[model samples]
Target: MKTRFGKLVCVCAALCLLLSAMFAAGCGNDAHQKKIALVFSHEPQRWTDGAQMMKESLESDGMAVDLLIFHTDEEQAAMLTQAVDEKPDCIVLAGGDIKNFRDSLEKAKEQHIPIVDYDGLTQDTDAVSYYVTFDNYGVGEAMGKYIVQKMNLRTGGGPYSIEFFSGSDTDSNAKLMYQGAYDVLNPYLESGQLRVPSGQSDYAASAIKNWDGKNAEARMKELVANHYQSQPLDIVVAASDGIAYGVIDGLAGYGGTWPLITGQDADKKALGCIQSGKMAFSIQKDPAVLNQKCIRMIKAVVDGSQPEINDVTTYNNGVITVPTYLCLPRIIDKDNLSAVSK
Candidate 1:
């Protein structure tokens, strides 16, 4: 019995050695794969479809990702600092004003941890690794053209007007979208082709949604109450689907249906509203394509490969003009909302 027990112990030791070798090999493989850190402005669930797309696409590329979500600007900066400390192979930042972390981001850059600025953009900074996002100005232009066309269709030969609700002032994405729309719409407004009502008019009263539904609802309510007391509003141009929903809720009790509304993000609820004809249109941007491009940018940096970039608008961080990738935005109206929603 003693001899049998010794033999069993030897067998167990041999198996353990084999297992250790296999585990080491697996660990080495994992280490060989690049490590990526994703720092986002908000929680994943609260993330716009665009954010989700980046996360999914990066993970699909066999790169290990660490996500750090910050709820506030300060928190975002702190996370950026911490990520730099971790010395990740490459760090990806999406959303919010990244301006708060220029110093820390620079530190990471000095350490050779390239940063891929995803979605949101900051004024030319040196910490940016590569920029992967849409042509925000183009998005705004689309909105403007669409609004003009819709107004013409709706009013025929009559006078019509519109209003705007922008995202947070700090968000460059919001600014680009708003500016794009404004540029396109401004000409018509100047030509007297479109008359925005009064300060109380929904089309005239502008509020910052900050990309929060609650904030959007509150702002929309204010617009509704103010406009109802004065003249009726004809159009609402919201920066996002979440903001548009808020406007709809505010208009719910206005004693009349709302005027034509335009939104972006093509969220599920937005799709539903479009189907019912309550919402006029939404710009459809595929999150998958957005994310895939983001990953490509990140992988290029991680693997030390050159990324394809549109240099004209690339962010000139002190070290390099990181490549910027611009995805096109498609407008979705009731005509093809179903196909676009899918």
Candidate 2:
């Protein structure tokens, strides 16, 4: 009986060794080296900055990342198709047109490859596994509220002249943001507290094509030539800081008082403008928190673990509602500018 117990102990030790070897070969070393593909339809400053943050975070986690950006929709589709063929651990759609890559993304879904939408919210949420972005409406509401407070409309009886310049019509966030501003400023419009000297108050009507600064500049010029030439405008709600810069340039050509401008995304140029009193303030959406959450989700999905998602109903990407995580936006002004700029 003593000899039999010794043999049993030897067998248990051998089994433990085999399990340790298996873990080291499969989950331990292999899972640490994950390959990720980041594909973008366009390379905007805000987008590229976020991409850099994601790349650094992933690389720090021992991930191999492929960052790709395209100028045309067709280019985006072809590249996404090629990425699907490469079969990286996962593919990140780093801000792009969803309609452009829906088919290729579906192919990925069929192959069980995970897809992440990093700020490019499309109507086709079914093609994406997870969606993440700042609360766009909240960003707009913050700007509207700030403008209202700055104008002192609560106590002042005068009607302030204002113009609204929304971002591109193609961007889904643009609509939500404008709608948020409209929700707050509409009451003032009805009460005759806020007036549009340019008479272009509709969101759709004032949308900047491509969100191009040149186009925005042209529109501002037109607003001046048609309406503000005789007198300086009081306020202009520029949706993005990029658009605000253009508005500022156009106003520079004006012979009247510089108008108050509101913007989102605390880009360097816009921040400088705010410091110089050209712009009022901006809402900043920091990418650090979002990128960290993104890394967590990617790690879970790659390791065959389910990720945590909070919003299941707010975002419907045409085909199906995709699981999402929403990040709140923060208002940035002179009070907090040093924290970021300095």
Candidate 1 structure quality by residue, lDDT tens digits, 104-150: 87798689788777777655567676787788888888988887786
Clash number by candidate, in order:
4, 2
- Model 1 clash pairs? 125-317, 126-317, 126-318, 163-203
Per-residue lDDT tens digits for candidate 2, residues 279-336, read 8888887777777777788888889898878788866766778788878888878877
Name the regions of candidate 1 deviating beyond 4 angstroms. Answer: 1-32, 43-62, 73-75, 99-103, 153-156, 199-209, 314-322
How much does candidate 1 score in TM-score?
0.80
Instruction: Please list the C-alpha lDDT of all candidates, in the order they appear.
Output: 0.73, 0.81
Model 1 misses residue 332 by how many Å? 1.6
